[model samples]
Target: MPIADLLDRFRPGASVYLPGATGESLALAQALAADPDRLRGVEVTSCLLPGMNGVDYAGLAPDARLTVFMLPAATRESFAQGRVRLLPLAYSAIARHIAAAAFDVAIAHVAPPDAGGRASFGIAADFSPIAWNAARQRIAIVNPHMPSMRRGSSIALAEADLVVELDGPLVEVAPARPDATARAIAGRVAALIPHGAAVQVGIGGAPAALWAALGDHRGLRLRSGLASEELLALADRGALASDGHVAGIAAGSEGFYRTLADRDLIRFADTRETHDAGRIGREERFFAANSALEVDLFGQVNLEWQGGRPVSGAGGAPDFAAAGIGSPGGRSITMLPATAKGGTISRIVARLSSPSVSLPRNLADVVVTEHGVADLRHASLDARAEALIAIADPTMRDVLAEQWRSLRTAMA
Candidate 1:
């Protein structure tokens, strides 16, 4: 069907869910926003939109609303201006939330049908399947440019209520290069991984660098929330195990997509399957490496807020951290620079000013910084404080030690 006709199917007051991140349909979103009158009173929900295509829902129509689960750079200003509604939830709970809401329509960008007439969700599988199942109308933009993925990452073409053929390039996001501090942290994180480990890497510069450091390690398996070019490099180097990789999303440059085209090494699953704490806990030798904005003396990780505003969501950090640390042979590693703001501010603080805590102290295992690694897995309160302080910046170590002494004295 024509793009205009496909868009005309949307009715007033309809609730629509669009796949976010690299799986967003830019052409479809542009068509939806072309005429405000056509989509008056419509509610659109998505997260991590890469470009400025469908951000201004307020401009589309006075009654139109945009709801987001996670704040992306493109939509942050819109959210601050009250043009977008932020639904704060952990990444693992997103699928459940969508199922409860029961959207009217679910639009996803997917690869063309394979030999078995199946269309892969491609790079952005996070919660698309859950939303699509709950939505009244299932619409798919079949793009040949999308990589044909393997395993349970696909949906049948017959299942979609409407199919619109579009030939366009997928959105590309270049990975950020890690600096010297980040590389040092990555090295410490990589040292914690054992051979034949099931690794879950979070999104960040340090995590990206960690992949490069692990290229020499053998029999490593990736079970992550997002896949990047670095992961492909690991596979190319024969570092990943033969059991295959499992992830929720594929985010990297166009070259990365080309590398994954028609490959069966990675399987994409929903957030529920990928980020389930209990399931991950059962996987032996699970190692999770994540990044944090700030960590307190109590070992609490703060990934959501900085200064008083929300920069990112909790995401899968908490889920993976608990699972990795809980597993009998698994380990959870948190990496961050010892300081920020040109070495003026300490990231390891006595207390977090932000109310949000991504990971509690109990779940923390190994904390890594450029200075050193702090193993807090089996430490008491006093011991944990000392271990964390040792990895902190050299200049702040004495101050942290003094603060620890004062806290102990007050408790006594």
Candidate 2:
């Protein structure tokens, strides 16, 4: 059927699900945006990542509403105007929410069917399966450029459900080249992970540098929520224990996606399996590395909310951190630059700028900054303050110490 015909099928006030991660159907999203009349009075639900997928679904039509777990830059305006509904759910909880929403239509961007009549998710295996099951109808905009993979998530391709064929490249994010500060933190974090350890790292320069720093380690495995382009280089340098890794979604450049598809290097999983603490803890030497906006003396971490609004989401940070903490032989590692805003502000302070249960003190087994590392797992309140202060930016140390003293005086 024609793409126009599919757009015409949408009823006013209907609920729709747009797949997140690389499975997002840009063709459909663009069509809906171009033809606002089709999306008016419709409710759109998605988990569009912060850095990717900049379409403003809620703004497509005044009556349309977007419900999402992430508060990316694109949605900030809509959210403030009451057009977007922000769901403060963990990465795993969002999956459960999707199963219950029961959207009227689900748009799936996929690779063409293989010889066996199967379409794989290619780089995205995050939420398509759940979205498909919860929707009344599923429409696949088959893209030939979308790589077909032997591993990761796949669904049976049915000709009857094929609505339109679109030719476009899937979204790609270039790997962030680490700067000196990122490299320093990465080096320290890398030293903490022993050989043969399993690690989960979030995206960004610190992670990119950490991957490069681990080139000499052997028997290392990846058990992560996300896989990026760095995995390609790590594999090339023989840093990984095996070619097969467990990742919920692969987000990176076109070259990396193609390489991942060609090599079939990872097993795609959903948030449930990837973030389950028990399952994650079963693996020995599991380390979850996450970033934080700030850390208090007690080590409460924050990944979301900045400048009076949310710039990010909790995502899988808490999920993986909890798993690493519970794993008897594993540890949770939190890495951040010691300062922000060109050294004008400190990231480690007497108190977090905004704390809302992102990650508790217990999850902060080890905190690494460019200056040094703070092993907070076995430390007391004062000891944690001391260790954290030691790792803080040298310029901010005296001020942080004074603040800590003031806090203690008030408590006494």
Best by TM-score: 2
Roughly what TM-score does model 1 have, to 2 decimal places?
A: 0.94
lDDT of 2 by residue, 1-412 (tens): 7788788767788898887766777777788878988878888888888887788889888888999887878888999999999888888888889888888888777788888878887777788777887778887777888887787677776733545788876887777889999999999999988888888999877988998888888878889989888877888888888754788888888888888888888888777788887889888899888778888888888888676568888898888988888886898988889988999999998987774757888777889999999999989989999999999999999999999999989989
- Every candidate's lDDT: 0.82, 0.84
TM values, all candidates: 0.94, 0.96
Off by over 4 Å in 1: 36-39, 49-59, 410-412
Root-mean-square deviation per candidate: 2.1, 1.5
lDDT minimum window of 10 residues, candidate 1: 49-58
Highest lDDT against the true fold, candidate: 2
lDDT per residue, candidate 1, 123-234, as tens digits? 7788888888888889888988888776647888899888999877777777868999889999988888988999999777899899999988999988888888788788
The pairs that clash in candidate 2 are: none
